[model samples]
Target: MLAFSKLTKSQASYLFSFGIVFIIYLISYIISPFTSNDTPFYTLIGRSILQDHVLPYKYIFDHKPFFSFVLYGVWDALMPIKTGMFTLLALCCAAGAATVASSIWKTNRFLVFFILITTGAAFKMLSGNTGVLQIFFQILVLYLLQYPSFLRIILSGVITAFAVNINYLTAECLSLPIIFLLYHNKKIIFNIFFFIFGVFSGLFILFSPYLYSDPLALIEYFQQQKQFLAAYSPSFTTRLFTVIKLFCYVLFFIPVLYVWVQQNIFQKQERIDPNSILLGLWFVSGLIASCISGYPFEYYYILWFFPITIMIAQIIKKPEKNFKWFFMPIAILTLFSVVDSTINNIIKYRNIHAIDYVKMASLTKGGSVLNIRALQTHFYMADLKNFDPYLFKEHIDIAFGSRAAAHYMHDLEQKPLSVLLPYQGCEIGAVEATVCHYLHENYQKIYEVKIVKLSGKIDHFSFELYKRKSGA
Candidate 1:
């Protein structure tokens, strides 16, 4: 074993940081196999691709491209369906942790620890979401930006394309190419070609045979996205909180802003270097994208944090003792926030008893298992087999979310389907009618009753199994 005593401060710090991150990754991997919402959906899609050979456009609810292909591909290849999702989620978490560690390493090593503790990076890793992969690509692009070689430029473009496939919002980081063009004015043509190649490659993967029967499905997908954007509402309070959270997420941005301000006032020539301009533009672009996206989720905004963190590091090359103090409170707050969020998530996971619900639905006979107002459809699918612990029934038709139900109902010829509606947000009459109409065109007066809990709590207004009267 290598001795720590003989190593220099920098070497020792690097090793220690790697060890800590690896340990966190290992722990996350161990716990990730437990059931979660999206896990089964991913598995289903992957299985569909492999077993049924069906393109996913008609079945997958969301219009986003087949971005999860690689993730699911690896999952199917490695473990059994359910186990694969957990393993893949764990790997994604590891990749994300590694990304954050590298991005922050150049600037301030302490901040990485702070991010892990504050962000509940470990918990997020176990959550089995794509946020980690998103962060990984962001850092990869930033690292590539530093190098000026043709191969690096091409690689960066390819990575950016892959990033977009993983999550369309990640395409926002393509702005990095513009920054590169500005920095390398002499090699503009090369940058253009590199970008075009990457875009085409990404488009090909996005529109693979597994995505749609016809390539036009890609166009339909974009049209849907347009509608979604047009209908989005801006939340000012959410925007303000996001801004504050990002600033606090990294302690150095405040100082970086101050530096930029000082440079502007003094009209300093050296301060306006290519690097500063690139970093400034990136930060601004990311901020605008995050703000405009509306109803900002934490992971969605975290992608931009990588570049901002790196920029902040570039700003504070040599710091005073006083500067270190600035990070203490920020670090403490971040740690607290991460811990709090992790604990709350854990509680929610325990309370939901998601596996039990899935199993129960699987065992119920004759009709499809409908989870109204459910968040993650995949988790429900994963639990179907487990619910019949005695191995009674083999499989059940599982559907969740308004969109998923809508899609399924559109294809079904049967009427009077029984559904188990969860106690979600306030039930809207119009929404329910719209859902009901898709299943049955004609109205019929059927038995109706309000479902109430044993504790005298009003559960839901149930239209007791409505079906259209024949020839009515």
Candidate 2:
């Protein structure tokens, strides 16, 4: 029952911007051109939790921390609307980024609104990646660290611990906040000691479920997660290409780096702002984290959006004639890139009904359903149960190495009533020779629907469903 009249201009502006971003995201999800690979995987885990009351680590083989799934689970349990959940997560991210930018720039906070919503990271969040939600928590810590009180510093530590539970790699950001404490506070030792104390306290609270339920299982879970990550390390060459793609292809990096250079190298007379130093450190931390797994995933770069946008706002706040020429073209190119991506996404939307998930669901009823060489989305959309520990192809390949095909062959022996293949019939993973041969010989092709993607070109791909032959 609050009136807008009582609120300050800044507060009202934030509310209006938040509403606009949320509505835009909601509409974006409704007409989203493509679905990300990770969405279906996480949604399935959320479904399992709500319907079966079992954790992912216990029910299925998953390496991610439990917070995100729990968030999804709780939401689905209450409302069970996919688009609604996506809009909410996207809104959280926009709000967090806007708040962080506001803390840095007293005026022209709306400029960040445009920078954030137009970026590739924003689109990825709209496509339903839980990693976006983790960034929400990460930004909370970032904002809290800017002006440090003992309570605020301690709270930031607790939130940092919570963020790590969302995704352990965010642990790299731990140093940035601690460095803030050292820079800003006179009683560094006392503040840092309490910050560490708060972190441990957060961990204890978050992990209490595992501790009370089965401490050994929690230990084993981390061990398995560590091993899986270690085993899946990309080669040095691959990691180098990932870095190249991030810096060279993403145009937004230009302004962020330019501002840093302008401040540090060009304008040496003016004393550097402490806030700028922390933002720089955060940018470095995000870059290091993004490149850690050597994944060219668009969502990983989301970590950079907040700090980068804040840096972009600085150019608006204090214009320097020195690099005005360099900055102008870079800014225009970045905007064009973003606008092109958005139009392409909308243009790619196809009216063709790709997969008849309903018929597939009916055909696969009363028996197990397996999806091969298809996205896990096939399982979720059709409401089919995936009774395999290896939910993803990459995970299986990484976890089993040479034994991947053997594992697939073993799963085939279960004789799932219907096998869904998004690729052509008799086609599986590279090592899936035995799987292809077995499916061809024993399973009957009952239904298929062309998968017309947002690319606007039909590659002649279809989701083909197969049933085992009678007494095969």
Candidate 3:
């Protein structure tokens, strides 16, 4: 321990980075047992790869690129889907945080604190979003920007390509400003060649088995992305809030801008780091992409926050002692906001607790289940398509809220086995209502099953098993 403490700054930094990463891993593992809709979806996809070698497109409904499938590789190696995904998420978050910490350490300590606070809040708020992997790749790009060695350039290009795979939005967020800067600096020839090589390599990996079979499929995949963007819209209130939210997001960069302006006004040729430029571009590009994307979710905006935090830290080298007073309130508010939002979401979507219902449903062996207000059960069944072949083979049927069932079932291949349960009084036009309507239509065919009490007072729980009559 004495010898370790006496190590050089570089050695100490490396150890600190490793320690922080380990802590993140521990936190993620602790939270893994409690599941969510998004997590199970990733798990199900990972499990599918282990069971079936094919990449799903039409069946899964998510247009995520091949980088996400890298998680599948990790899952395959790790064995359990939840453990693999959480582990990967934890590692990515750590790597991203470390990149920021290391980049800013030489520049400013106060900026580092702000970066830590904002990043911590962002991580906690968007815990299960899987956007962290893309953010990590973005940070890597920033880290590589100043190096400019052949190796670093190649690696940065590869990281940028990988970012596209996780979410095309990442590419959209990081690409324009990077290209613009490259062009303005008259590095177009190099940029074009590098970009082409990266794109080709990325496509080769993305479409390995099917590249020769049908290249049009990859083109169609991108075309669908455009359609998705076109179709998205924000609610009226959300639209108004989006503008205010963007202003708040911009505050993360104020320090950096202040420093840049001050230096320019004084004619001081402050040696501009290439990494700082890359981070500025990343933040600017991401902000523009989020704005144009129209139906902006808070998680989508988070990809920009990390890079901006790093930039701000770089700008404010040694803040005044009194500066802490102002920073403390902002940090506290950010923490409280994230915590409050997370708790409210958990309460609203307690579907994470519905894992018990999933286990119960799995035990029933593909039988029709009368789910009360549990629409997540159907999504879980969809996700478990990789796990339970019997259910996949038999088509696990569900009858829930009218809107949910109608929405989910419209795309389902088979008609529901039976819809006998009635919508409870608290629910409006719910599964119970749908079941009541079904019962009214086919009175002689269906029978009711046991009703159970659930956690919430307003939502009474029940399960009814239904079998189709042979003649009908």
Candidate 4:
């Protein structure tokens, strides 16, 4: 009921900026090209939660923290939409963009442009990776830290703890940047003390469910997670890509240094450069995380988005006026790339249906459904149980993957009711002789679908749905 005329310029500007950010992200999600295998992988955990009325820590298989799975569970209960994840993703990115817009300008054009460019990359490659969300939280903390207030510091600490629960690698790399931030506080001791205290406070919230269920179960979960990631360190090719991406990210900072020097040296101004140093640390942390990631996939680039965009904001005096013509071509090119990706996704992102198999699964209660490399999105949609609780099935199938997978597949005496093989990437069934032999002996192929994805040429995939014999 409030009138617009009654509002101040700041309020109106804030709302306008929020609207712009929201629309950009909304468009990004609407035109998104692909859904990650990760989407349904996490969805399976949510289904487990709904059935069990508690987190399924008993399935000591996956490495990710338990917090995200709980939120996914709550989301499905309320929204119950397949693409609901898109909304969650867009909202987080929008919030971060809005924060930058509020400080930088009405548009913060460069920041928005950066997000659109990289967001397309994310949808194409890192769609369901947690790195994007982690950057969102990191930006939020970055903004809050600008004020250096006691309350803000504590809140930053709490949010950071939550961020770590999302992805241990990216957040851990931020340690030096955080230390740099703490050094700038007026009362360093008090802020550091409270920050650590707030971190423990956040940790309590993260661990409460496990503490309530069974204390030792938490330790067991940690062991299982470690057993899985123990062999996940980067390979030679991964490390090479990490170096290349790091070099590319460093190029973005030249403008930041240009701005920093212009303001401090040329203008003959004397001021602390803590923000610059912190921003540099932010970039370094991302490089470190990428190096540590067993595979420096495209998604890892998401971490660099935070520091780079923030640095751009600091560099441009008037984003719209400064960026008017120079960035116009870049903007067009970025959008074109994204649009091309969208078109490619529409044509190439194949969804090999398994309706008949899911329906058959429904008929048989207390039956396990095995999904090979293809994530079992359908099983979760039907609220069915997974044969293997380790939802990140690809990692389990890879070279030097978790030993638990070896033990789990050691005996195939009791085969699953339904098995899905998308016969595409990795084809672990072709590599693992024991598993291949077991499938050959017990399961029979009942349904097959051949789908063609054409980016440049036709890439055909044959999906085979298998069912065990009546009394196999």
* lDDT winner: 2
Against the reference, the lDDT scores of all candidates come to 0.50, 0.67, 0.50, 0.59
lDDT string, candidate 1, 29-55, tens digits: 444344344555565555555666655
Which pairs of residues collide in model 1?
Answer: 37-379, 41-378, 118-334, 118-338, 359-387
Candidate 4 lowest-lDDT run of ten:
346-355
Query: Given candidate 4, what's the lDDT at residue 67?
Result: 64
Question: After superposition on all CA atoms, how large is the RMSD of candidate 1?
Answer: 8.7
TM-score of each: 0.65, 0.82, 0.69, 0.78
Q: lDDT tens string, model 2, 230-268?
A: 887888888998899777644645755776658654676
lDDT of 3 by residue, 167-227 (tens): 7787778786557545544456875577557657766766665666567766766675555
Superposed on all Cα atoms, the candidates' RMSDs to the truth, in angstroms, are 8.7, 6.1, 7.8, 6.7
Model 4: lDDT to the true structure: 0.59
**Candidate 3 clash pair list:** 111-313, 400-431, 401-430, 401-431, 402-430, 422-432, 423-432, 423-433
Q: Clashing pairs in model 4? A: none
Q: Model 3: runs farther than 4 Å from truth?
A: 1-29, 32-36, 69-88, 100-119, 122-126, 149-155, 180-188, 212-229, 233-240, 249-267, 315-317, 341-355, 363-383, 386-427, 431-436, 439-472
Candidate 4 C-alpha lDDT tens digits along 1-472: 4688897999899768655654554454444322554555665575566757556556424567776666556555665455536445545564565466346323365555445344435334235456666676776666666667878888888888888877787465677778877877678898788788778888888788779978887788787777666666557887787688656645544545455445533555576466656667777787677667756465666665555555555556534334445444434434554565544444423442423546545544577767665545545545556666644546555424545345446534557787766653225343365665677678777766555544442233345667787778
Q: What is the TM-score ranking, best to worst?
A: 2, 4, 3, 1
What lDDT score goes with residue 183 in model 1? 56
